[model samples]
Target: MQIGIPKEIKNNENRVAITPAGVINLVHAGQSVAVETRAGVVAGYSDQDYIDAGAIIVDAATAWGQDMVIKVKEPLASEYQYFRPGLILYTYLHLAANRPLTEALLASRVTAIGYETMIAPDGSLPLLTPMSQVAGRMAVQLGSQFLQTQYGGKGVLLGSVPGVAKCHVVIIGGGVVGLNAAKIALGMGAQVTVLDINPKILARIDDEFEGKVQTLFSDHQNLTLAVAAADLVIGAVLIPGAVAPKLVTAAMIRNMAPGSVVVDIPIDQGGIFETTTHATTFADPVYVVDGVIHYAVANIPGAVPKTATDALTAVTIPYAAKIGKLGVTDAAKADRMIFTGVNTYAGELTEQAVAESLNLPFHSLSTRL
Candidate 1:
C-alpha cells in the first residue's frame, strides 16, 4: 500500500499528519510512504528525518497522487483538485458542517474517512481525543490570555491573590474536551463548574474532580445562570458527526458581564455559540461581541504544533498503518471502527449523522460497499 503525507495548508495548522517515526512504522508494516517537502518542518521534523526513516520526499502533487492521502486537517478548496476516484482520504474531516467539501468528495468519488467519526470498542473517538485534549487544555490558556487588560479583558487574574476573588470558569459538556478544560482551569486556581445533560457523565465528573468542580445539569435555566455568572465560559460541546448544538444563545451572551470571555472549542462544527458566525484563525482569534470577548479559533491545538503533532501521530499512526496494510475495503470489513469512519464512498454519503446534518440523503456504508 502507498500512503501520502501532505503538509497541512490550513491557516496556522503546522502539525503534520505523520511523524518520521510514524513513517518508519508504516515502512516496517510493508507500506510505502511519500511525504511532501517540508511537511514536518514546522512540527520540528526535517525532511532529512523522514528520509532517514525510509520515506520518500516528493512534491505535493506526487504525494497527493498516492493511493491514500493522510492529512492533519480537512482539504481546503484549493486542494480539492487532487481529489479523484478511488483515492482514500484519511483525515479529521468535519464534513457535517462542511457542505462544500462533503459534496466535493461525493462528486469525486473519493473514499473519505473522518478521524473524528471513527469509534473505538468503548465508543471513544481515539483519533479525535488527542487533539480534543490539546484543544481543551489550550482553551483555558487562551481564555486566560484574552482575559488580560491588554487584550481588552476584565483585568482579573485567573488565580487571583489572597485579597482578590478567583475567576469563575464554566465549561459546557462533560466529554474529553470539557474534562481537560476543567483540569487546566482548576490547576490555575479558578473556580470551575461543568455542565452536561447526561447524569452519568456529570457523576463521572463529580467523582473525577472530587468536589473541587461543581457539576450542573445543562438545561436552559442552569445554562442561563452559569453563563451570566461566568468570568470565563468554555463551550466544549460535540455531537460526533453532526453540527454542534447552539448551546450559548445571544441573550445569554448579552447577559454576561462586559469583560467576560467565551471560548468555543467546537467551532469546527459550526460552533456552540449563536454569536460565532464564522471561524477565526490564530492570526485573529478573538472578537468583541456586545463588549464581551468571543474566542472561536477552529484549531486551538495548532498553536502548539510541536506537542500536538507528536501526540496526534502517536495515536493516528497505528490506524493509518492498519488501513495502509489492508486497504480501505479489507480494513473496513475487518474493523467496525473503520466502517464507522467512512463518510463517503463511491459517490455516496455513507455517514448517516453527517448526511442528516447537511439535510442530504444518507446511505449506509454496507450499501455503498
Candidate 2:
C-alpha cells in the first residue's frame, strides 16, 4: 500500500497527519509512504527525519498522488484538484457543515473517511478525542488572553488574587471538550460551571469535580441566565457528524458584559453561536460581537502543532496501519468502527447524519459495500 502525507495548507494548520515515528510504523508494516517536503517541518519533524524513518520525500503532487492520503485537516479548495476516483482520504472531514467539500468528494468519487465520525465499540470517538482535549484546554487559555483589556476584554484575570472575585467560566457541554475545559478553568482558580442536557453527564461531572464546579441543566432559562452572567462562556456542544445547534443567539451575546469572551469549540460543524458567520484563523482569531469577544478559530489545536501532531498521530497511527496493511474495504469490514468512519464511498454519501445535514441522499455503508 502507498500512503501519502501532504502538508496542511489551511491557515496556521501546522500539524501534519503523520509524524516520523508514524512513518516508521507504516514502513515497518511494509507500506510505502510519500511525505511532501516540509510537511512535518512545522511540527518539528524534518525531511531527513522522514527519510530516516524510510519515507520518501516528494512534492505536493506526488504526495497527493498516492493510493491513500492522510491529512490533519480537511482539504481546502486548492487541494480539491488532487481528489479523484479510487483515492482513499483519511482525515477530519466534518462534512455536515461543509457542503462544498462533501459535494466535491462525491463528485470525485473519493473514499472519504472522517476521523471525527469514527466511533469505537465503546461509543467513543478515538481519533477525535486527543485533538478535542487539546482544543478544549486551548479554549480557556485563548479566552483568558482575549479577556484582557488590551485585547478588548474586561481586564479580568482568570485566577483572581486574594480579596478579588474569581472569574466565572461557563461551559455548555459536559463531554470530552467540556470536561477538559472545566479542568483547566478550575486549575486556574476560576469558578467553573458546566451545563448539559444529559442528566447522567451532569452527574458524572459533579462526581468528577467533587462538587467544586457547578452543574446546571441546559435549559433555555438556565442558558440565558448563565450567558448573561458569564465572564467567559465556552460553547463546547457537539452532535457528532451533524451541524452544531445554534444555542447562543444574538440577543444572548448582547446581554454578555462588554469584554466578556465566548469561545466556540465546535466551529467546524457550523458553531453554537448565531454570530459565527465564518471560521477565523490564528492570524486573526477574534471579533467583537455586541461588545463581547468571539473566539471561533476552527483549528484550535493547530496553535500547538508539536503537541497536537504527536497526540493526534498516537491515536490515528493504529488505524492508519490497519488501513494500509489491508485495503480500506477489508479493514472496515473487519472493524465496524472503521466502517462508521466512511463518509463517502464510490460516489455516494454513506454517512446518514452527514447526508441528512446536507439534504443529500444517504446510502448505508452496508449497501455500498
Each candidate: what lDDT?
0.93, 0.94
Q: Which stretches of candidate 2 lie over 4 Å from their true place?
A: none
Per-residue lDDT of model 1, residues 1-369, tens digit only:
899998899999999998888999999999999999999998999999999999999999999999999998999999999999999999999998899999999999999999999999998999899999999999999999989999999998998879788999999999999999999999999999999999999999999989999999999999999999999999999998999999999999999999899999988999999998889998898999988999998888888889999999898888788898888998999888899999999899999889889999898888655
TM-score for each predicted model, relative to the true structure: 0.99, 0.99
The worst-scoring run of ten residues by lDDT in candidate 2 lies at 360-369
Q: Measured by TM-score, how close is model 1 to the native structure? A: 0.99
Q: Please provide, for model 2 over 1-369, each residue's C-alpha lDDT reduced to its tens digit, 9 standing for 90 to 100.
A: 999999999999999999999999999998999999999898899999999999999999999999999999999999999999999999999999999999999999999999999998888898999999999999999999999989999999998999999999999999999999999999999999999999999999999999999999999899999999999999999887999999988998899999999999999999999988789999999998889999999999999999999999999988888999989999999988789999999999999999888899999999667
lDDT agreement of model 1 with the native: 0.93
